[model samples]
Target chain A: MTEAATTRRSRITPEREAELYEAVLDLLREVGYEALTMDAVAARTRSSKATLYRQWGSKPELIAKALRHNKPTSLDEIDTGSLRGDIHAMMARSDDCQMDRDAALMRGLFHAIHGNAELHQALRQLLIEPELDHLNTLLRRAVDRGEVAADNPALDFVIHMLVGGFVARDLIEDRTVDREFLTSYIDAVILPALGI
Target chain B: MTEAATTRRSRITPEREAELYEAVLDLLREVGYEALTMDAVAARTRSSKATLYRQWGSKPELIAKALRHNKPTSLDEIDTGSLRGDIHAMMARSDDCQMDRDAALMRGLFHAIHGNAELHQALRQLLIEPELDHLNTLLRRAVDRGEVAADNPALDFVIHMLVGGFVARDLIEDRTVDREFLTSYIDAVILPALGI
Candidate 1:
């Protein structure tokens, strides 16, 4: 291996990367994106700053990757016979506490994403696009089943609606996003829009 | 007038309060909620720090009151014979540039709101609840007109959907929240979900 490759391989094993990412997410939850620092992450993980810089490049990129790493399952792995069943099955994967924590993490990230263009680009490319592709796959299956029409404009905004439901709940009602709420939202708002 | 009234009248006239709130909003846009301080507002408006404290009580209250003052027209005054007309008129009240500025301001506030309880309470009490009350009036009109069922679950979530549209546009699509996008979203996602 080249010297650069040798250094990278020595520094970041799969387990080590996972440990670092967990530290990053814990710091993210504690202090949020604005207050979090590379120095903090390095100290938390007992790694050098140079190692983190070599591994992740920058704070935004690190946070973006950490968030991506935090997802419990790939949306692609979820497959149920019906679109409604698929959506509910997806929601069922996480318990209430996990959903609450993930919602809180996302709330902070949304603001950071707005302010930082690099973070926004990294998240869209690394995290968002992949999930969207997975969601589109689900939608494609639904369309093929003739559950939703091909010309439905609501298909274009499924992510927005889902994300919106997650976000607007706290802002408007000061409520924790839970499976009950998501299930109700999916049925009332999402399904109706899709003409299901 | 009592001594307290005299002191208050001397420090702040109606016009002076408007000037201070305008300065506060300008600073909020430039620096965001966390960076904005009473000292900064006092400096910008040429008011005493003591006077500001006595008037607004806290930063959250000041920011919330300023946001309330920034509204162009009350939602209650926005009756246009039909719900669709009222919604469109509300959209038309602000031009594209103003909408862009407001949406960006809101995006920053959403993050701050998630973290700050006092700010959230002030905003809900001073800004959000009043708007929701007005929106409820609009929905009530629709229900009375036989346009929508009062029991529809989506009725409870119109604000969520609207707020989500404003927020999710930037995060997901990386697009500016414009009239065209909102119009399409309303027609496709919101209206259909409402069974309108």
Candidate 2:
């Protein structure tokens, strides 16, 4: 139909798209994924609902874009020579990244993802996949540098430890992920687990 | 109110109460926590809703009773002579005490507990508090035995590693807890983390 064609034709520049995505993150932090609506996002960003619909197609897609925008890149790249130093730097980088409000937002996102397959997939792609990729890159570097064995049995457990530690601290213990905990975790658990 | 007092006066005996609680667990596993109701529990147990109401005031309370009934008791009394043996046994016990169709029920419970504060408290008391108490007791024993120093730096991290490992495997990886993972986890991570 002509209407569908018009909706598809109205495209914004990349700069405006990034601005809208940033606005979505702000809204997500303020209102959470469950309470967020396209109307609210459009109103906040001074855009139209039609524009959002044409661009993202659905609420999950919109929230996925927002999560991707705010996704932490603290562990992207670090070459501290030794595996211990690299892990130390990686843990320290994530120190200031822990926000109490973020935990609430994460809980909201988690609730949104449960029972909704589309949202779950979108969340894994935007949020979970990126972190996994970054950790893989870091571990791959360690393997190449001969810091850890190429076929280390504990390699699989490292990622689980990092993520599990944070989630358990937040959800179970109801505490912020602290720097002291991260540092000792690296020295005591991570390095030893990986047999480095 | 007089009605409330009258309702409280019609309490059932402990044996009948246990039967009703078991029926609630069956309904929860079969139909899920969200779909579960007092009527369904009463019908399943061949009891009246009045008796159910007299025993437990709310749906959350009923579910809490079911959880308490099914909770593992050995997790609290893990004194296997050594800290390593105690932790290994504790972690491995999760594999033996299996619940039928529990994964789906747990997922449903996770969703149900998010927004409901009373349910959250009840779940913490029924599910989480027992495990925490057991772990705390084990750690206290370790401290008393001087196997681990009183000023052990990685105590919290070790606890997190053990508990977090299983939770993450279940929630994120969608895997069942097994003894092999638990043994490797204790040997590779917990032992070194405690400098054993």
Candidate 3:
């Protein structure tokens, strides 16, 4: 525990904490990770620097946790019975606007993640691994039910294809990723690769 | 043309110009696009700042051109008479170390591209479009040969899949993309999706 945590633990309510995380994400979207400052977060959230530091310890910790908080769905809980259904449900969880915001936020984080090892580790721990594990479970269920081949190589690239779909939208066509595009991509590229 | 073009367009030899571009790319890999400066390029290449600015007009133009210069293969020129062979040749154009360096350089550029509209336009015009056109030609040839159906929806995602394969390697498995990995991915994921 840093100086802040030892002084005040659990002082802020969960509702207030969520608001703080939202503020962090808002700043991230507006200015990106490199330009974002602890001072800015404190001012945006109307919280003391001491409180912010006490709660999160550092900027990477705060940013990583904020990203985690922004994820509205727990992927592990999404079970639609079929692999196709599950994948569609996962994409449908976020609407068009939310997906756009998420894409920008992710683009903002990519540079910081590349430069900062601490941020990278935090993200892998707090954000990426959990989601990967959840998706793995979803795929494992597909394999169990014989919806997909157990030894299929395309299985390894499912995440890459999905992520590339999201990241490439702006670069390829200068378009925003929406549920409709993802649905078509799922139907066309992903399913065909999996031999579904 | 800027003052550089009018003043002395052909003063720098082709070999010297290539050396300058290589220095710019080395600086990009070291300090990233955000921090790269004309002064640094001049100092590193033993050229005057005025000459550097006059030649390239701006950092974005220089960086974009450097990236184009660094591409050892004219992807358009790779005609192996088979889509698989063409792709494998594309991946094999650079050795393993070059791929890792290119990946790092690309990761560096991602943040700069997000923030700088000017850099983004230069990159799109000078770097991305040419490559896309080349890949499209390759795909078109494959269509002509009946290796892949023209109407296949996966045709639209071919670039996205290949790019995702490059970008996602570090993100997912923390691995440097090599010829073997890309070859396997092409055989397993891309080829199967194209129904080859």
Candidate 4:
């Protein structure tokens, strides 16, 4: 490998990158996007500021990269032979992770994303679209299987249902989107709404 | 009336308060919470910074007071004697107002609320709680009339459905929570989820 490639590879192994992302996510949770600094991330992760800047260039980009890397695999693992099965499995799998911290991170980023175009675009591109696309794929499969009507109006708002609980949890109740909450949500809200 | 009461009443009439609130909301939309200034509000409303400061004491109090004063009446009017009608009526009435900028104002306050405990508490108490309480009241009335089951599981999450649309609208689709969207949401996801 070229000297630059060699340095880059040796500098940030996949495990080290994951550690750095975790530190970034932790900082993001502790301090919001506007207050989170690259220097802080580097210090917290015991890395050089030069290395962080060389890797991500800016705070927003670095934060986005961190979120992108930390995304749960449940988004990509929803194909369980049926819509109900897929949703239940996804919700179940998603429940197996630490969600409150994730919700807080997403909440922390909310205010920053509104005013920053580049950060907004990066967040959308990196974190939101893939999960949304996965839901759409599952819905399409349901339609094809006659489990859900192809012209169902509810399809348009399923993302709202799936994602809304997280956004409104703080506003509605002082609770996390825990397994119990998700299970009640799927059975009461998602399944019945799906009419399956 | 006493001299102080007479002077206060004459100086800050109900109409004057509404005008000041309007100016604050407008400035909040333009510059957001961090950048918005008492000086700008004073200038926009043709008042003095001293007057603004003497009245509100701080930016959060000013914005919170502005929001409290400008809150729509739809929250109180969702008593149409039927669950579906009440929801549709509430949705329709909420739609009748200038929603986009209201949503924008809410968005602008998002970041500030997360960081400022005083602001978050004020927002939830002054604005969110009253409206949410109204929703709860409507649901209770529906249950009393047997339009909904008192023990329905979806009851816990109806807030998530109604409020989630606004929270996730921009995040899910590059759109505002408009009338048609609310109408479709009510018909498609909400009513069905409620088993109505």
Candidate 5:
């Protein structure tokens, strides 16, 4: 409704968009998805509702973009010549995974994501798949280097255990998943399970 | 509010309460937590809102109780002597860890649990901690039986691996955590990590 007939659009600079995404994630951490509204987003970003809608179409798309923005791109860059080294590096990346903000963001998404098909698919596709793919690539390299058995059945779910440990640590155990904990986890649980 | 003037209340039998819990879990699976309401529960159970309010006092308590009621109590009774047998039995218990209903309940609770202090506390106190205690007891027995090292560092996070594996199986991996899969998990990942 902001523009019914005009095809021309004012281009938003990447810097502007980045600021907007940050505002969205902050609001997501504060209010969560069920309570998150486009009006609130527009107000926080100091932008028009029509502009927001035109850019993202819906709340799920906006939230998904925010999550994608926050995700670290170090997966492809992780190379330490050994599977053990790669795992330690991957687990130690200083992303918001261990931060309170990321935990809040995850908790915000938990309940609303169940019946929300668009949100579920968006999260799996954007956030979950890339991490899994990276793990697969790492394992493949290990196999190539003859460091691991190619047909080890544990290889299939090894990523899930690591990922879920971090995911459930707080929610289930009320324990903080810090770097020290993850490094110990890598040495004790992960490498041993991987047949080191 | 339904009966501010009435001081007298009718006591529902344990059987009726179980039926109501079943109804709550079913509605949770169907409509999820946000869309689920006391009215929907009342209608589903053919009961009055006042009755539910009197029983659990709130939605979170009701959900927490339902989870507790559904939990497998055989954890205390599972004594296969060896730690490996105990873990295998624990993992393979057929409470439908893969069933869509339980998954839906988990999904439904994911986002709603955060920022909801009442619900969060209810889940931890009523559901999560009991399971953790059961695992602890099982491990303690194993330690005394000399089946596992008393000072093994891996014993600390071993529960996390088993738990995180099941929790993330469907959501993260899209694979079923079946008996055969868990059996292999016990052999390949669990035993090796535990040095069993």
Candidate 6:
């Protein structure tokens, strides 16, 4: 919201921003959101807390910046020529590459989102909304490709279930994400649920 | 594991155990798992911490006892004579009764589970195993009645999805359980996914 905050990100080179964001994520994984202080982040990155505060007005804003900057590029536009292929590609991407530090970072993010409305909104804006938008784009492309019905009632719920199931399984069961689980989920649940 | 522990539970009447467990849960909700000391529980219940320690042996054991004792009863064995009717009843009961303290208690349990392996095992034994057992019972009954297939691929996944979905929705979306959402979920996703 502050002018310095708005320009701080722009002033930094893209590579430096990525380095700082990665540092923040590493701290999140190490200490969690509650204990993640800007001063600690500044110390970790060898920057001053004043610089961080100038860049991001609050902890949530700082976290939002980190999350937004580190958004997974695994969901790149994969045109597999069919909805099933696209879905499988997406699920496989989720199971393989997307479940590493992101899942652990999200656990911390979940705690942050619980008690802070501002953090929750920032999460929605920085993390959830972009992912949802990507999924919507994929689904819309499927509709365009005629691989699925345009009136897919289960689209949103399917995406929610997939992501929700993975996170819940990791958090609750402490299990590694298996490709078999994801593919079976897609084949048995999401595909049929969508009447594909 | 201690003789004193068994003797305490057996010697105390069921009503007394219920009262004590309720008090423990109240304390858990108030102070969270890390801060929930036997001393606090004793003070809250007008008993001594020694009695709590003698009875439960450890904090994890005590918390597990509280969770087990306070678990919601499974939906009445509905002889509604149809799988859909039975599932609807079960889901409705979950939406209405199992949600209030269960949500807060689960959050506390998650925090405890993350911190202590012994507590995690105790919680799984006390909380998760029982619910999964009940679900298995319901599904087995449905299979026996010819309402659902014995080899339903999505059976296990369905249970996980329902529980995971509800917990994730409640925690993430901050929405109370809605009957319509449950019913539509059953119709749109669960039943179909199970090949019913």
Which runs of model 3 end up more than 4 angstroms from their true locations? A1-18, A38-58, A68-72, A125-127, B2-5, B8-21, B35-72, B125-127
Per residue, candidate 3 scores C-alpha lDDT tens digits across B1-196 of: 4575546658888799888888888887776666577888989999999987877778887887787666544554899999998877766877999787767676667667766776666556654676678778888999999999989999998878877887777776767788888888898888889997
User: lDDT for each of the candidates?
Assistant: 0.78, 0.67, 0.79, 0.75, 0.73, 0.69
Q: Which CAPRI level is candidate 5?
A: acceptable
Runs in model 6 lying further than 4 Å from the true structure = A6-21, A35-65, A72-74, A94-97, A144-147, A150-152, A171-174, B6-62, B69-75, B95-97, B171-174
TM-scores for chain B, in order? 0.77, 0.72, 0.78, 0.81, 0.76, 0.76
Model 6 agreement with the true structure over A93-112: per-residue lDDT tens digits: 65455566655666555545
Q: Which candidate leads in DockQ?
A: 1
lDDT of 1 at A11: 52
Q: Which tens-of-lDDT digit does each residue in B26-81 have in candidate 5?
A: 88767666668999999999999998898778887788777666654445488898
Query: Top model by lDDT, which number?
Result: 3
Clash pairs for candidate 2: none
Ranking by lDDT: 3, 1, 4, 5, 6, 2
Better of 1 and 2 by TM-score: 1
| Candidate 4 chain A lDDT trough over 10 residues, lowest sum | A89-98
Model with the higher TM-score, candidate 1 or 6: 1
DockQ of each: 0.61, 0.31, 0.55, 0.52, 0.49, 0.35
User: Candidate 4 on A41-78: residue-level lDDT in tens?
Assistant: 87899988988888777787788777767654546555
Candidate 5 lands at a TM-score of 0.80
Task: Output candidate 6 Cα RMSD.
Answer: 4.5
Superposed Cα deviation of residue A98, candidate 3 (Å) = 2.1
Off by over 4 Å in 5: A1-14, A46-55, A68-72, A95-100, A111-117, B1-16, B46-57, B61-72, B95-100
Q: Please report how far candidate 4 places residue B156 from its true position, in Å.
A: 2.8
DockQ of 4: 0.52
- Cα-lDDT of candidate 6: 0.69
**Which candidate model has the greater DockQ, 2 or 4?**
4
